[model samples]
Target: MSRGTRAPRAVRAAAVALALAAGTVVAAPPAGACACGGLVDGPAYDTSVSSETAVLQWDGTTQTVLLELDALSNAPEVGLILPTPAPAEVALADPEVFRELDALTAPRAVVSDHRWWPELGFGSGSDGAGGAAGVAVLGEVRLGPLDVTTLGASDAGSLGAWLTERGFQLPETIQTALAPYVQDGWSFVAARLAPEEAATFDGTLQPLRVTFPSSSLVYPMRMSAVADDTQSTRTYVLADHRVDRVDPTAEAYEPTVRFAGRVDPATVESAELAALLRAGGFVTSHEQVFTEPGTEIVSDFVFAPAAADVAYTPTYSVVADRRIGPFFAGPVLAFAGVLALAVLVIWSGRRRRAPAPTLAPRPAGA
Candidate 1:
């Protein structure tokens, strides 16, 4: 139940207190409005050679989102398209918990280290200004020069038209492949540009690619803030789970663990414990059995490393059925000791009785 994104209680409380601390004051609306919600209307720039870039900064008081169009080899008509504020999605390490900082103006403040330029909408299209029929929605709003070819209500089509009209070209092969998804996936699609070559005023757009693990892998989604820093970074890792080797009870069990701090998985040593179990005729596999402190390990006998730095106290449940044999040497030696004692006592009593019998014969002869 706690697996989803949850905001820290203290963080949520502070956010509420901060909101209450600020007195409610309404400000005037932004300068000019565009059909795609809130649009910034300005002179059209001939950005044929450079890429378009928008930089947004949000302080406690105001949010400033700046758009820069680079005039490179082929310039297209560029516009900042803002839809009526849709719900913003913020990813958290734990999805179940909702944090308040994310709910507020944080989206307006993309971290400097992780700075990114998102796609804004178009200037007035085919029928001039205020035409609800054609509005450009540039999908992948990254470093690359967007090629807008369609002018319609949807941001994707309009952005495409804007790019094509200006001299930007889309490969027929890629266009054909994306034709089916033009309606749905286009909104989530944007081209990636090289990070090192990206600039605020350059028309040359860079391409970016991100890879995520498949669902079957057990991975950790971690988020933490550095000292004296306002931004937090979230990272995901695919690590093999292991049990505590010293504790025989936990040898075969593996559980996913979360640490308040960072842990280096490369230095972990549970391979030896797995080897020991194999020696005892047990097979081991890396499958998550529980959401506990240690890594998940499945085996016949207990499996864990001899020395491990345990991050949390864990409870292990093991159901073991073993056969005990009568040939055990300790019990056999104990039974032999008792039998020798009985034989010694019988011999002492017999010697005492035999002497009495001889004495009785002597008395009769006398």
Candidate 2:
């Protein structure tokens, strides 16, 4: 099929179109790969740091995903490892959906001039699933420019050896990092640029779309522990309710909540994303910190059903009063004081200028 073909019409809003518009799925960088399926930092410093964006849409117990990955051109080999809650159907994901998401959720420099007497305001700025394994070769399939395989590793040690044995050039630390998820019974999606398409591999790797049975949305991230330092992640969640906040599960930094707002289905431009957001839901963006070797977040994401009759508020906002109270409070209170002083000064000035009260005119002739 042509690259222009859209994803299944029904799922367009929930997810983006599946497949690259032009060339096959490809990328560069030796990303040891993230347990959450992110690209690991590699020696290829040719390009500046890369950013990945993933889209997740859940229907009941199943989820549709699109992960946008970046790679370099002319790289002989490039591959990715993604852990899943259960078996996954792998295919090329659309790049357009990412454009829509970036467009809708990208941070805006909101200049809120909350000032004294409408004078000024302080500016505010805003911002998966799967299963187990054995030496088990679950399956292999080809989706466009990608050669895909489903893998199951018995344990961390064996899995490391297995990847090396299979010609996957990566470090031992990555293997050690996988221990947690491997011990917890998670499966993986392994993909590489097809040999024939390697030469033409563009920098933008066609996001691989994976669908599977996930009781809750989750991205295996326990393996990211081997990362040299905390990894920065920004994720856009399109779900029925706002996702819960990220905390210091491991030694990683806390996730920053960008925004929790109603989804504008029309803005996203994906039928699937639009419908899903329109159903009384939200699209939340987050900047998170995950320490290597372990994560405070068990799964990258888990669809959190909005608690019944419970009002939901952003935790940061709940504490927002404290945030601006001191900064703006002083200014506003000072402005009030100054304004009061100005009024008093004006009254005194007028009284003094009033020709000594004029003695009530001739009525005081007595």
Candidate 3:
């Protein structure tokens, strides 16, 4: 796609007035890839996504997804789109939920004497033509600075056109990417920050919570193929058993398990978060990088219970102190003592021999 001319400052408001479309949940910086799927306006600006995180909690019949993204853009506003299997309820999610999950499933710190440090969506139908085009505007709500709309479309073309009509620049590549989801009859949640609020939008955005019904655990990813760069997606799944990603096509591409173990709901401060984990189960974390999302990812991530409920936690060895003081003190001290003893023995042997020879000589003289 051609990198269009930089949007003029005067046009910023007009651009913001257009739909800042969004879908699904997950995050990255403006330079990085977006999780789930979304498109950003003002490609002329240095824009990308970073630090994308998604927390999915499934309790058999219902699923709640919390999404957060660190978006970097000079544009007046960015657009994000999310696709769900069913109509979804969108609201502002507690940022603390992600913090708590980070703390919960974070790599277990193993101290080994030495220390190393490391470190959406949618609905729509405001336009009268929307209903006729097989696109249903299921609902719309405003949360904080976000205008969220939920929409259902019978085909990808209609969905793409709908977003384009509202000012989202949907490239042909992105339109093709949306085909599968639309074919599967998925609903979308489109969101954008209000123009006034987005003008001063710092990269840090409030997380969003989307609740919907699903028979199985899943994270929408098909729409991410529109990303121009590779995207790193980290997802935390809270379920009754240890869960893992299942490639419907059995492709080699799959996310590595970062953590899979049970957690206590009481430890969580958010009542909503705790309630999701109230049934006492495991929280599995997965990290996947879509280097070529357009080709590498052909399906949304569908998770299921692992064959074995083994627990896995990523760990790193940390040296408590880099100083050799304690680690080598004992060995160094012992070596020094042995060296001293050896020197003493050699000196005593040489001095005694000399003395014996002198005594013999004196006796001979007498």
TM-score of each: 0.19, 0.62, 0.74
What TM-score number comes out for model 1?
0.19
Could you give candidate 1's per-residue lDDT for residues 66-166 as a string of tens digits? Answer: 22222211212222222111111111112111121112112232222321222257974231122223444322222222321122234445544543443
After aligning candidate 1 to the native by TM-score, how far in Å is the CA of 137 from where it should be? Answer: 4.0
Model 2, TM vs. native? 0.62
For TM-score, the strongest prediction is: 3
Instruction: Please name the candidate that would achieve the greatest lDDT relative to the true structure.
Output: 3
lDDT of each: 0.23, 0.50, 0.63
Off by over 4 Å in 2: 1-35, 38-49, 72-75, 109-133, 246-253, 275-280, 290-303, 306-366
Q: For candidate 2, lDDT tens digit of each residue in 1-366? A: 001111111111111112111111222123444424433222342211244557666676777677764433222333345667766777765567677766665555443443433326688500001222446677777776655667777777766555545444455566655676677677766665455654554334455677777776554555555554445666666666766533234224455655566656676666655665675457666656554434354444433544432322243211222124545565677777899999999999999888754555566556
Q: Which regions in candidate 3 have their CA more than 4 angstroms from the true location?
A: 1-33, 113-132, 322-366
Better of 1 and 3 by TM-score: 3
Residue-by-residue lDDT tens digits, candidate 3, 1-366: 111223323221111111112112243334223555655564455555545566787778778777665544555434656678888887777678777878887788788774322212466412222443868899877776556678899977778778766656665666676778788877877776555554454444567778887877777766666666776767788778887778652256856778888888877898867876876358888777776766886767787788988999889987664434555454565677999999999999988888444433456556
Consecutive 10-residue window with the lowest summed lDDT within model 3 = 13-22
